[model samples]
Structures are given as C-alpha cells and as structure tokens.
Target chain A: MDKKSLTRRLGRPVLGTVAALAMTAGMLGTGPAKAAESFKIGVVTFLSGGAAESFGVPAWNGGKLLIEALNRGGEVPAPYDKKGFGGMTIEYVLVDEAGGATKQVQEFRNLVQREKVDAVLGYVSSGDCLAVPPVADELKAFLILYDCGTPRVFEEASYTYVFRTAAHAAMDNISLARYMKSKGIEAKYFAGINQDYAWGQDSWADFVASMSVIQPGAKVKTALFPKIFAGQYGTEISALMREKPDLVHSSLWGGDLQAFVLQAGARGLFKRAQVAFSAGDHVIPQLGNKMPDGIILGARGVNGLAAKARPNALTTWFWDAYTKEYKVFPVQAPFRMVQGLLGLKTAVEKAMVANGGKKPNAEELAAAMKGLEWDAPSGRIQMTLGGGHQAIQPNAIGRTKWDTAKGEMTLIDVEYYAAECVNPPDGTKAVDWIKAGFPGAKCK
Target chain B: MTLLRSVPAASALAFAALVLAGFVLPDWAMFLVTMAFAKGLVALGIVGLMRGGLVSFGQGLYFCIGAYVSGLMANWTGITDIFLLSLLGVLAAGAIGTIFGPLLANYRGIFFAMLSLSLSMILYGALSKMTTLGGTDGLNVAAPTFLGYAPEGRPLGLALYLYTSAIVVLVGGLMRGLFNSQRGLIALAIRDNELRIEYLGASVRTAMAINYVIAAVLGGLGGVISGLAIGHVDPEFSFWTTSGEFVFVAILSGYLSIPAVFVGSILLEVVRSFSNLYFPNTWQLALGIFLLLVIVLLPRGLGSLTLRRRKAKEQA
Candidate 1:
C-alpha cells in the first residue's frame, strides 16, 4: 500500500478504537434506569489464599445470605414501613483487602468514590479497619465494620459514619476475666501470645487490667506479639513455652491461629498452662476434634453454643438459615456478617423514619449511623461517639467442648458479657489510659 | 535525533502544570498525583542503575528506610514539619545506603538481584520486630510543614507538592547531565563490556560503588516523598514484593528517559486503579498478563518501544 493509504488506514483504526471506547463507556455510564435505582452495597474482605478460606470465606457467605434475605423482604410494610426508605433493591460488590493497609485504603476509596456504593459492609482484619476509619470519616460514607475487633475503632469513634457490629478487644478481655473470676480461678502469673499489631496489643492491655482487678498482684510472666503475616511460628511458640506461666492468653486468628494451635499442641505448650485464646474459633472444627480436651478456649464472639433453654424463634431461624445455606454453623468472626446486616437494617429503618418516610442519601445515611442501636445475631450493638465512631456490643466467651458422639467442638458454658463494664471509658486517650492503669484506673 | 534531546522543555512545563493543578484538585486526585511523582522519583533512581546494566530489585528497602526515618523521627521527636523530616529522612537513607552499596556493588546478574531482595526482606523483618516504630501497625506519619504552614490539607499542600516536584524534576535534569558526561560513558562501557572496561585500567568496583550510592540516594528521596504522599509508612514498604514493584516500574519505563519513569509509575497506578474498578477479583492476574506481554513484546520498555519502531521504519 502507498504511504498515504497506510497512514489513513492506521488513523481510521486508532480513531475507531477511541470512538468505540467512548461509546462503550457512555453505554456503561447510563445503565438502565431500573438498575441505577438499586441500593448497591460493596462488601470488602480478603477472599483468596489460606486466610480467606477460613474467616473471610464464611463472613462472605453470611453477607451473601443477608443480602439475599434483604432482597427477598422487598418493600417495608406495617411495623417496618416507617423504617423503609426508597424502593431499593440491595446488590453487592465484593473486594479483597489482600492483607495490606494501603491496598485496603485504596479499595475503600474505589468503592466509596468510584463505584458510588450506597454503603460498605465487611472487613475481617484489624489492619484494614484501622486503615479505613479515617478515610470513611473523611468521605462520610456509611461503613458497617463487620468483623475487625480491635479497640482502636472505638478509640477513634468521632467518625459519625463508621459503626462496628463485631465485639471489641475490651469486651473479649473483660468477659474472659469475669468468667475466670466466676469460675473461682485466681491465677497470679499471666503470659500472652498474640499476633503483633494494634489488636494484639489492645487485647494484652485489656487482659492485664481485668486480670489485675479480679486477681490482684497478677504478674505478667511474658508477652509475645509476633508479626501477623509471618508464615512460621516455631520460634514464637518456643519463646512462649519458655516463659511458662500458670495461665496463657492468646489472640492470634486465621492461618496464624491455626499454625499457633498446631505448633503449640505439637510442642506441648497447650498442656503446659491453662490456655485462654481470644478468637479461638479459627482453629476449632478444622482442628477442633483433634484439639486436646480442656484447653480453656473462647472466641471473641459467641458461636456454636446450644443453650439449655429453648432458643428464640429468630435465633433458631438464623441458625437454620445459616446452616442450610453454608452447610456449617457460623463461627465467631463471620457471625459478625449477620450482625452487620442486622445493624445496617436497623440504621436504615431509623433513618427512614427520621426522614419522615423518605429515602436518604449518603449524608443522611452517615448521620443515621451514629448513636444507632440494634439487636443482631451476636446480641445488642451500640455505637458510641469518641474519635470517629465505635460500637460497643455484647461478647460471648465459652470453653471448647468436644462431643465425641457428634464429633465436633462446641461452646458448652457459653456466656454473654456486657461490653460497657470492660470497655475503657470514652474520651480518654490510650496513652493516658495505659499510664493510668486501664479498666481499674478509676475503679481503684 | 537523540531520544533524550527531544523532551526537556515540555517535561519542565508539564511538571509546573501538575503542581498548579494539585491545589485545585480534590483530595483523591491530589493523592494520586503526588503518588505519581513519588513513584517517578524511584523510577529515576532505577534509571541510574539501568544505565550501567545493573537491575537492582531492592529499591523498596531504601524507600522504606526513608519513610520510616521520617515517621520515626516525627513520632519520637514531635517534629511534624515536612521539610525538616524529609531532609532528615533522605540523610538517614543515604547513610544506610552507603553501607549497603559497597556490599552489593561487586555482585552481578541474578546475584545482585537476589542480594537486593534479601536486603529488603531483612529490613522488613527488622522494622516488623521493632515495636517502638509501631511494628506491623506502622507509624501514622504526619504531613509536611513548610515555613510554619501546614502543607497537608488543601491549598498549602498544592504549593508544597509543586516545590517538591520541582526539586524532583531538577534532580532528574541533574541525572540527565551526569548521564551525558564522562562517568555516564564509563557506565555505558561497563554495560557494553565490564571486562573490557576493567582491562582499560578503570576500577569497575569503585565506579559501580559510586553508582550504587547514587541510586540509593535517589531511592531514599523517593521513599521520603512517598511517605509524605501516602500519609503512613509501614514495613511492607520494604518487603520484597514492594522492591519487585519498583523494579517492574524500571523495566516498564526502560532507561530511555528520566520522565518515562514517572509516566511508567503513573501508568502502573492508573492501571491498578482501573483494573480494580472493572475486573475486581482477577485484576492482579490481568496486570500480570499485561506486564508479561509488555516485557516480552516490548523488551526495550514502553518509552523506547514506539520510538525504536518508528526509527527503524524511518531508517529503512
């Protein structure tokens, strides 16, 4: 071909590609009006690799189920009519945090700004949650923090848009201390093995405070906080064993939790002292049947419990629905997914009523999230004002009961503890609180 | 026409324009733009090494060191001012780089790459172990201060960004000057045939050692800028994966031009954001595939690929 013809041909293709891209983008930009009317909820969670298969996978399943239920419920009527806002159909966009704070922050931005999501639900790691709180506040998006249990969220509870459905480190630590006291076990020496980060550090602080209150003169024999994403833990385990105390507390979760359990079991660390793991659900069932009996375990939230009294119909319905859908009972962290959905429902309902039965936008939604209370699968949840926003809720602590007949690990003496009793008083800086001596700072 | 000779005036003007736009743009755009400049700085550092045929995969270590130094210093000393912290950060990384450069200057091929990767991992391990620096939680670094003005929020941030970017571009110009000089010729000689350069009575190790220090200083500056841009600095900034990413940016841009590195970094961030927006689940896979094709098909990197093809056709 001649140069003129060849140049013309190339130009045509380049122009055609640009035109095509623009047209395609325009078509996508204005999706059918009906599709645009739907209330889109973006669910961000780690879903690949070993960590996802356990905590994130189950949490996603729970979130999926809740979305299905919300869609099935249709427009609000009767008692819920006051709460119903727009003719909204709920949809979800799932994102992976991938175990990085910066990545998770960027993901949050993409969801809130680019995707124009109405609400966000799902996070299983403390790092992701910590990374998100400031951004969520800045963006003014209604963020339902489903499963990051670090107390830092509450400490930074000034963000009116953020609300957590899961139990915090304070509740878990305080509940365990109270439980131990009730059991007439006053242990003097204490040791801890937790994943190194804000969550682990907060857990240790809360545990020390509560333990000191219940059993005075409790000496911290050892405190080991290993980096969270480190693959192997033989060194950390050996160190914990060497520090040998009368009691050991751990807050490791996900793959880290399983690795710790396996190594501790193999190395006879579990058998050394009475072990109390906060968020022990990650190791149960998958290794529960194999876990040596009488380990004195507890997950952050109550799961796998069979109450002596007849359970509530809603509770029964939730369990049946969850089991039928997932083919397994809900565990600790994922259980927050159901709680998150329930909390969001409560917020939406309250907002709708407050707006005089009108549909709410992002700002109204953000405002409604603050000071909201709801009854969820885990129990009552309350959002308190502090830095950005934080929710204090009930927590369940239970022993790992293996029923040889059923071939499972169950929570036998499951007990619910109020979060307010153990939580550090609001408006107090963490640095000052630590220096002043935690839950017992004022009490003493 | 020489490739480097074609574009200085245009780039200088473009950098000025970006700094001005940073003020009017919203938070998100400001974040993205600053990120582009920071990544651009790192790319420039890699360009220095690439000029000598050495592919250093551990720029992340230097970047992390810069960031951590600023973060640690700020938190420990309550010095939230941007200029002081950044200068201190660069100095800290440069000092450490001098030590590391000598150790790495003698190695070549896969050995050099592996050594850099190991160094980054070692830094990651150390940072994670040091709880006072916030460990895995990382230090929440504050924004830079300029002459008693807080340059973090909106208006002032834009001005500060402009000042910082101007320095970066000026540094790029300086790099260009060096690349066109005697030292650059010898570096190219090393790239062509190190054995011949050594036989010519030049101490290759000493030359490479100086080159290593230069790259380290550049990488450290990039790190400090990135830490300022991102608002937080963590140990992951020093991980092997992060280091590999810098190397990927270097490879993607090729060593054709100083500004190509900036474009490459911007392109990477843009592609990542775009991929996440559309593909969601398999975006990383898509990125991998795209990068593979680009590397295999355009081995000279994105900057050189178009020019190389056009030049060849013109010659024919």
Candidate 2:
C-alpha cells in the first residue's frame, strides 16, 4: 500500500487506542488511593517441601486466619478489639520459604523492594532466621521471626528492625527439664537422640546443660544425632535400646519425630526408659492412639491441643477457629504464628496511636514493638530478652496419655512454668546462663 | 591468534551488559541475576564433565567445600576480603579435587555418579554434626569487603554483582578456550573411545583427572561467589538435591556454548521465583511440567535454538 493510504488507515485506530489507554490508567490510578490504606505484610512460611505437612502449613494457616479476622474487625480480645492495625486494613503477601537460605534472602528482598511490604513475618528454619535479619536491618524493614527457635538471631547480631516473637530454643529445653524435676522423675543415666542440624543440636545442648543443673550427678550414657529428615531410626533406636539408659531425651519434630516414635515404640525402646521430648506436640494429633502413654513432652510452649485447657478467651477463640477450619487441632507452629501476629497487632496499634492514627513507618513500628507485651493462644508473650528484640513466654509441659476410646493423645499431669523460669534474662547469653546454673532465674 | 579465536565477541558483549545491569536493575533483580550467574558456573562445570562422558551427581561436594572454606576463613581468621576468600575457596576445593581425582579417575558412568553422591553426603553428615560450624543451621559469611572497602546496603549488593559478573565472564572465556585445546579434545575423545585415545599413547586417566580437577575449581568458584552474595553457607549446599539441580541445569542448557548454561540457570530461577510467588503449593508441579515440556519438545535443550537460527540464516 502507498504511505499516505497506510497512515490514514492506521491513524484513527491508534488514536482511539491511546485515548482508551489514558482513560483506563486515570480510572485505575484513582481507585486505590481512595480506599482505606492497606498495611502490607509479607508472610513467609514453608508451603511446600518436607516441613510443610507439620510446621509450614499450620503456621501459614494461622497467619491467614489472624489476618482475615483482623481485617474483619474485633475478632480478638481487648487491646486487639479494633479491626486492622490502627484502622488501616491488614493485607498479606504470602511467599514460600521452602527453598534454602540463599533463595529466602532473595525472596525477602523482593518482598520489601518489589512488593513494597511494610513488614515481614515468618521463617520456620533457623538457617533462614539467621540469614535474613542482617538483610532486614540493612533495608530498615520491620521483620518478626515467628517460628524459628534459634537464639543466635538476637544474641549473635542485634538488629533494630528484627524481632523474634517466639522464645528461643533454650526455653523449650529448660522448661522441659524443669517439668522433669518438678515431677520427680528420678534418673541416674541420661541418653539423648536429636536431629543433627542446628535446631536439633542446639536443643540437645540446652537440654544437657539444664539437666546438669537440675540433676547434677546424672551421667549421660549416649548421645545420638541423626541427620534432619533422615526418616529411618532403626540404627539409632537399636543403639538407644542397647544403652538402656534410665531416661531418654529427643528434640525431633515434624515427620522425623513421628518416624522415630513409631520405630522406637515398635522396638519397645519407650518401655526401657522414661522418655522426654521437647517440641513433641506436633506429632500427637498425627500419632493419635499410636503415641506412647506416659512419655513426658513439651510443645515448645503452652501450645497445640494441650493449650485448649487454658482459661483465656482469646485462647479458646483461636483454638475453636483453627480446629474448625483445619479439621485438626493447631500445634506449636500455629501457636507461635498467632503469637507473632498478636504482638504485631499490638505494636502497630500502639504505633498508630502515637502517630495520631496514621500508618506508622518502619522506625515507628520498631519503636513500638520494642518491649511490647500481648496475650497469645499459648499465654502472655513479653519482649523481655535480647534488649527487647527477643520474646519470653510461659510454656506448659506434661506427660502424654493415649486415650484409645477417644482416639487421641492427651497431656496428663500438666505443669506450667513462667517465662522467667525458663528463658535467659536480658543481656545474658543462653548457654552462659545455663552454664551458670540459671543464675537470677525465678521459677514459680 | 589462538586466544583471540577462542574468545567470542558475544561473550565480551554479554559481560559488558551484565556489568551495566548492576547500575540499572533493581536490587532484587540484580540479586537474582548474581545468583543465577553463580549457579550457572556450577552448571558449566557439570557440562565440562558431560563433555568428558562423565556425569557427577555430587558436584555439590566441591561447591559446599568452597562455601564452607570461605565462611570458616571469615569466622575463624577474620578475613573479609572477597578476592582472598575467593582464592582460598578455589585452592581448598582444588586441593581436595587433586587428592580425590586419582581415585575418581578409575570410575565412570553410574559408579562415578554414585561415588560423587556418596562423597557429598559424607560432607553433609559432617557439617550437620559439627556444632562449631553452626551445625545444620550452617555458618554465615560476613559481608565481604571488596579490595578492603566495606560497602553496606545497596552498595554492597551492587559490588557483589559486579564482582560476580566479572568472575563468571573470565571463567566462561577460559572454559571456551579449554573446549578447543588439546587437553579438552583429549577429554572428549576419552568419552567417545578411551581405548583409542590410550592406544594413541595418551594417558586417559591423567586427562580425566585433570578435567575433574578443573571442574572442581569451577564448582568452588561458583559456591564462593554464591556464599558471599547470600552471606550464608549450610550443609544443604552439599546435599544430593543440590547436585541434582546442577545436573538438571546442565542438561537444560545442553552440551553447547558456555553462555547457554547461564541462560538456562537464569530461566530456572525466574520460573522458581514466579511460581513460588503465585502458586506456593504447586510450584513443584509447575517446575515439573516445565521440565517435561523442555524434554519433549527440545531434546538438545534451549541451546539448540540458537544453533538452528544461525544455520537458517546461513541457508538464507
């Protein structure tokens, strides 16, 4: 076609399209500005891979429920009675934490820089928790580590913008040891088996340190550390059976814990020794009647089906909502996640009030969260450690009793420990505190 | 003349583009590209082994070694210089490779793959059990200083991207040269007919061992850069699945040009990031389907498309 005819043919349509595009852009741009401001939170947890079934899914579900309830208004008790954070609706962008630490760091940056999230909550792996804090601090973004149990995130490198809402690994082990002492479980020989990774190794070290203080003369017979997600426990169980220590301890969680219990139970290892598990509540619902009776265990805190007995209204609401939605009782993971969200809610609301009910910036949010206190499904979580960057919360420990008729594993002879009894005090390292026989600790 | 012939103009242009990317790309995209380049180097090492008729299911052993060595140096010795750390990482992996190369040279096919996997698993076990190295939680490498200058925040990321890009480009050029050298030809010849090469008075084992060592150094380089960029190293770096990822990327790139390996790695990362964001629960399924499509439609992988286009242009 000739140039003039071609230009004439295309000009009208091109002009029409440009006019439509400009109109659409104007229409779209105004819509978002008029709506109530949204407080964008990046929620990261394991949504796939091995951890998803036990920890990641439950934690993600908990975050989802909490955000939904908060957006709908007045789902939680007083102090959290207002909808959203200071009247701005809470919106979450979920990211998978299934990949290794490197990918997680990249995803975290994407959440902050690309998605423009104001704050981030969630990391189920200690490795991820350790890797992300520095980046978060550098970016000056508010980060709440919900479920990772590492104490090093705070103790090793202090960050102004990073906080862990759950108590560190030391608390779980110390509380369990305290429960054992309170119950008068006399044992001369102690044997422990834990996952070989950081979480497992740290838990075991804390347990041993606490045992030395609580049962000074007790000898450790054998210590086994199988790899994480190893699944097979035949050799380890056989080794434990051979030692036949008076007391056996393990910190295995998720599918690894389930596998170990089933294999050990079949081999009758539970009968030979009084066994104790830190972070054991995850497997109770999965094991049901299969869970051994009278084996001492703790759920990292006062979490899981065990917390259903707590008399708090918020606890009851969370338990009922989670159970009804998931068709299974919430475990330690969900409990930690809820605690994190609750703490975030309190911090945001406080910051909002300080800022005259407008959305708070990262600095204001961090300021508000420092030393914040709030009620959770587990109990009261207080920022009492790590210069107020770490949380200390009370936890319950008890022995398991399998009720065959009910097809459930129940916590019996349950005992609660105040946060001050277990967690390290501010400015003291956990290992150092335990080595010093928990100096200045007040157990009640 | 040989050096000039071996170096492709496209590689030089690509390197320049990557260096420029640091200034223009967003922080997250720059981080993603840096990682993809690092991982792509590991994939190139796997490709090197493939050309020698060898497939390692555990290049992650050397990769992990490089990362851990760099991390340990920073933690124990307080050496935060990236150049020195990179040198130490390469030397450490190369030393291990030299020690194990003789034993590995005797094995081929599935035996080589299994032995590689076994070696990596042993490292994984040891890393998991050693509490001082942070055990399974792994140790963090301090934010590396570039030439003794400490940069923080966006500057640190940009510095890392530039450093990583330069290393990848230099390595790629060296690899291309090796592909055309007498030693490289000898290695490929061994893959085709080891007996014939031996009959020609060439030492097959020595050639294979040399290639293996070279591959180890490349893997180590990739790991060190990655560890520095990410600021953490763990036993998962040596896990069998990690090695499998290298193999997967190598296969996806095909046994073709070095740049194809980088392209393949970048594509994989993009797919993973987007899928994880949009479909968290089904990302794995999404990756699986992508692999299925690639395998079915392009047996020689995405690399063949470039060759096909070139041939078509020549025909026209």
By TM-score, who's the top model here? 2
The A-chain TM-scores of all the candidates are 0.83, 0.91
Candidate 2 Cα deviation (angstroms), residue B168:
1.7
Q: Locate the minimum summed-lDDT window of 10 residues in model 2 chain B.
A: B1-10
Sliding window of 10 residues with minimal summed lDDT for model 1 chain A: A75-84
Whole-model lDDT, candidate 2? Answer: 0.85
Q: Write the per-residue lDDT of candidate 1 for residues A134-193, one digit (tens) a residue.
A: 667667777888877656556644556777766566667766777787776667788988
Give the whole-model CA lDDT for all candidates, comma-separated. 0.70, 0.85
lDDT of 1: 0.70
Off by over 4 Å in 1: A1-36, A74-87, A153-157, A186-190, A217-244, A266-272, A303-310, A385-388, A429-444, B1-7, B16-30, B69-85, B144-168, B313-316
DockQ of each: 0.23, 0.30
lDDT of 2 by residue, A1-444 (tens): 986556444543543353345333322222123245888889999998889988999888887888888889987777677888777888877888987897899889878876778899989999999988888988999999999998898888889999999998898899878877888887799999998778777888898899999999788999998877899999999998898799998999889999999999999998899999988888877888888888898888889866876657888888888888889988889999989988998999889889888889899999999999988888889997889989999888888887778876778899988899898889999999999999988887
DockQ of 1: 0.23
